[model samples]
Target: MTCFAERAPAVVACAMALLLTACGSDGPAVVEPPQETTCNGVATSVRMLAPFESVVLSGSSAACFALAGGDREYLVIPQLTGELLPYGGYGFRLGDPSPAVVARAADTTSASIPSLSAEQIFGDQVHSLDAQARLDALMRRREQREATGVHHGAEQPTLSVIGVPPEPDTMRTFSVLNTLGETPGYSPVTAKLRYAGARVLVYMDTLATSALSTSEISAMGAVYDASLVPAVMTAFGDGSDIDANGRVIFLLTPTVNALVTASACATSGFVRGFFYSHDLSSTAATSNRG
Candidate 1:
């Protein structure tokens, strides 16, 4: 990542100028603006001062903020409405019970098993144990198991842990290829759809198998809906763009893209943009314009 220290001077200057302009009057003493306004046509006002640009996200009534003065430019989407939709990455599912492995009783009549502690296994230096001491402790545990008729060479129980299954080899391969900057068997796909009356942006790694993995998407839906969606809706309700620059830029992530894919927005068409990068910072820093 590019260090902020390398870009601080320009950012500081732009921020200072923005702050000064926000203070209303140009004198050294800051003048306070009116607390309330009686503008009837539009209840809210969206302002874009120097060194900043406002943009309306395509197909949505959301406003995005972008810094215009610095070389390292990034877009900031305002808060979204409501809680984010739950996201589970390409991993095990929650609340699933682990498989239990049980051993057959060697002698059902003898129901007693010896209980051993750390002191018995490691002597007085349990806290300061060496590798040899650890090995000896493990050997003692093995002996206890052997005494209970649990043979070391016995075939263990085959247990399957209950959870989400592993991703397919195709998906795994695609993930690897994506990291290597190769678009082997899939092309980038994007779509725009309306969910609960709010516009949604969807980007997909459209593959041949049509199998989807949560690992390749973005998880910022709730934040975008809460912050950017309402603002866009308001601005568009009044028939205005959030930013005069016309387009809003968003740093896409795997989790966020996953949310769109899981939602009703994954249908063909409504394509807007291409897949850029999984790293948001790199995407933002390199995006010169929306």
Candidate 2:
């Protein structure tokens, strides 16, 4: 009885302490405040792209061109950014895809035809064929050209092309792969139509394009979703899912290209050349894989 009496107050005090800890405070649980996302020096123009996030792709001034599809676009941001330091492509005027034309001056020799990877010519970030695997594709192409006396044929060898740069004596016209692998016809004689630049050419296959006016804007959108988007994804993977959503969103805009329709700019006061609108609320069957 003496021992029990001695320990009773101590046990009661311990029980009281446990009860207080379990009860916590009379107010409520504390929560850390949500973090705020801010773009410090982001221009109002770039900031207004969307509420999610954005980045400025910088390197060279915007190279402008008119697409065979009647949509003129420019190279504002590089496709691969830094991985491929000089990321530029041949800008063929709007028609059928063809082999590169090395119109060297009579004084220049065949040895002057500089060789380059297929990716460099076709904009690997948008092309289907992998360049690294086919190192001698250019040689095979030359052989095929010699045998058939044809620059382009049904079996289009895509792996590499002659890296013909702009020279005072060499007026070379390189072919570029459009959305559907068709050429956009003869490329214009531009001073910047060389092997080195900081822009990626974006254009559609001439064969696939119709007389696209503002009325048939939905057709253009369909082409973009079906052909253009998949090509880009194939070229540059799906990219990081920055929004944490299962789908990836790619926002492509030309710093100089004009919007397709007035209706598109109704909501945002401006329109991007191409953008993905994944159905976040839908299932795999209905939702697009951005």
Candidate 3:
């Protein structure tokens, strides 16, 4: 699985104005050469750890692909692997029970399984030991702010103008070709996405919001039917299970940089976005599970 977001010009400018700098495989084995017809500019074939299932490449550029046959659709960047990540590549699943394994195609039929894990997207960086210690201190400070009522909750606002459904002229149609040679038998897949637009919620109080971890802020708004719910509550499209599973998609765009150090910001790539696998895995009160 991969999560990728475009690098905004403003964000790139911010990084340039501020100046910032910023997993994977095992065993050699038989590898199938990728087809000349590339999927999303990746000449190399990519494989997922899950069984050969359904897939759909979104948009004409084929920048994103969604893995099917699961409860939630796994939108991924086919170009990236655990180890090698470009500016716009990363992978994680919201409700997937198993760890994600997306890697360059190899004949692993006989060879030991190629190691795989999530990659970072643009602006997404992991905290180092020192950074974590700094974050711990920051969290304590945030707690004090909360005690002083500086962190009072409010309604989350959606970016109504953003993610609007595509019109006929604006909508681009394409077929999803099988990139992974493992599923040669699978037929070509095509789809038309009717975007009713996503519920793009923006946390209003940046000062208070930035103080808390993304998970904490998410709990404040992303949880289903909870107080201060972020998403516009509604049954998606006639209330039917599109994937025949009792689950809905949830994504969190956190400002992880606010909690990290300048060195981390300078070294680690910008973290544009990420999924909440750890938050979902928890059965504790903080878990996003509903």
Candidate 4:
């Protein structure tokens, strides 16, 4: 698909030296209302790096919006500290019940970290739809959009990206995945919004996002069970770059975006996957050229 025009970021972004970038806004437009920051009965916030063992998501600023109604909640993750680069889901804490644990975005300014996973936070089973197969179908739709000459289609939902440059070489990649998919237990396909910036990226999807590296999964599959990723997280929790192989991931979106699923390291080495999702955030507007 033809990539849209570039939008200039807010003029008031700060600087983040690491992860090769810094500061990006959560976009200025609010298409929805605001919601209270709570998962299950516990409160959730962007600042709390609780039970999460990997790099905590932080940044210059984050925006929060409310979901209409149902049995589910939604979050919009914008530019983060390179944490949103992967194609998976990651929260600040390990929710109970393991696979089906839950997550949500707290108030933009809240400070308490909530538990994660569908079972841990919501105490309900996450709809068990085979993530890989669904993604395959979605990818096929995107391919159709590319062929039928649809600049804006159901597959590539429009999204806005504003590049706030604090320096000459420094840059932050902004993304917004408006509508991903849904499951049986929760809501009906909410918009999985994401924004990856200097130090923060937040996403709200109803399932365990399956955009992860399959080759890596298969190779590491043999080792992933006893891999003890949390243990590694604990070791490098307090110190950045402390872990020699920090965490790496792949983006499996076949929609002609930026990077692809080739990032998996030999499908054998360490590629610390943090958060991942399928994105089609329809951001409209471009201030750079027009």
Candidate 5:
């Protein structure tokens, strides 16, 4: 399964910008969907890994797809309340046991996954050994700040690893197509859901072998829940717009630079302001526009 979120070079994460308003805690309220075609965007997905696959995924785009498993086939998803990411992708039910763990596994499994636009994003110069080592040091500093009760306008990187549920030998993984995650002190976020199953997670930036505050974990969990819980579970039963409800729709707006700048957002079939999208392999760059 493939899911994605937008990524920018700016590591300076802003604090929970607007006050952290209590999210859709009543849990995800179900909404009767409009006709599938009326709402859902064209279903699609980023490149995917083979079956029984796991890895860390980060991007500025949205991912779309689902999985099916078991003879009786049942999908198991972690309790993350977020909108089900949508896009054209392979289908399935049974998958790695947990998405959170899967997301985290991806982070650690590989030493590094190269970026699409290197000089553009990573060019900020992590200023350390490798990305992993630099990431490790960053996490340590975050802990010190929190311990000192330091408050700043910019929040640290959003870091938190999740365990994907283990599956059989075979599994599917997606190549980058969309973006994922919250603020700094964190890596990135991911969420994928379907009628049979859904997986969602908040990848906070921190050392894997450490414990997180109960409240911090709860808050991240709430973000996932706020976005997925009710959004996918009680979704309307219409397969026609199935694709639209599953993919992240692109609504591009030009930047002041005169060069085209793209902003990506998820448009689950259930959400408003979602539209159809065709593959337009594009990149956003901070460039000098004449």
Candidate 6:
């Protein structure tokens, strides 16, 4: 089989070239690369991966976009703050059928989170306030909501802990098999990486029999870690840090693997990923990262 390095020469070269350019700068003072930003109420710029082009949709969040290319089409939505629930299907809640339950139902493996406290996840990041104060504020808000008979959904809640970041390193790959049992037009075995960046949810029209191998999934993750992550962080004005705020969802169609089984779909032949920002007015550009 051809390795990812052989197949994606340009990806490797571009990444190295960018690094070299930064290091080779002659100035004694560090020269920061140009940053992208957006004004309030303005449309945010989206960075489309590869062949994916942006499409307009009404009544959608500023980050919502309909991407299409070749035979692949899907929607990308970036949530500002919400629970990063595991995927079971449309309407699937996180604890209703927990990650383990979902994996068992699908007859596939599930990702596991290491036993790390919020402080461990965000090492050295100072807390915005004391834990007691935050908890008091939370209790007050809950009391007000309860008295008013107003209840927020499971996914909608203000983040009480401000310093804890999502540890992407601990996020493992899991498969969602028998997806047809829950929702149609979904991949039979969907690979998911659960992290704590708001709750970026990616929806794609996957073939019933299509699935990515473990190696392919690793390759994709490497690509994300190397190229896409930096671009996304820069676009959001978060510098080069991976543990930044906001969310990004990627909609992909596996086309390179000849091992893929035949399946029916409305479209075919393209793979795409999307980046989003918390502020819709944040201007940024999309590059072909995957």
lDDT of 3 by residue, 186-239 (tens): 122222222122322223222233455546644543434231122112111233
Alpha carbon lDDT at 151, candidate 1: 53
lDDT on C-alpha atoms for all candidate structures: 0.26, 0.24, 0.27, 0.27, 0.24, 0.26
Candidate 2, which segments miss by more than 4 Å at Cα?
1-91, 94-215, 244-290
What lDDT score goes with residue 1 in model 4? 7
Report per-prediction Cα RMSD to one decimal.
27.1, 30.8, 20.4, 23.0, 23.2, 22.5
* Of candidates 6 and 1, the better by TM-score: 6
**Any runs in candidate 3 off by more than 4 Å, and if so which?**
1-76, 82-205, 208-255, 288-290
Q: Summing lDDT over every window of 10 consecutive residues in candidate 5, give the lowest-scoring window.
A: 9-18
TM-score, one value per model:
0.19, 0.18, 0.25, 0.18, 0.16, 0.23
Which candidate would rank higher by TM-score, 2 or 4? 2
Q: Per TM-score, what order, best first? A: 3, 6, 1, 2, 4, 5
lDDT by residue (120-193, candidate 6, tens digit) is: 22333212222222222333343444446534442222322324444533322212211111111212334334
lDDT of 2 by residue, 175-221 (tens): 32111222212122111211121112223222323434323544544
Model 5 regions more than 4 Å off: 1-199, 207-214, 236-290
- TM-score for predicted model 5 compared with the true structure: 0.16
Candidate 4: tens digits of C-alpha lDDT, residues 211-235: 5443443444334223333333333
lDDT of 1 by residue, 1-290 (tens): 01111121111111000111111112352222222222222222323233233342211122111121212222222111111212111111111011111100011111122223456454543222222233344444434554576456764333324223222221211121111111222223332211111233323333322333343333444444455554443333432222222222332335333322334343311112233222111122222212
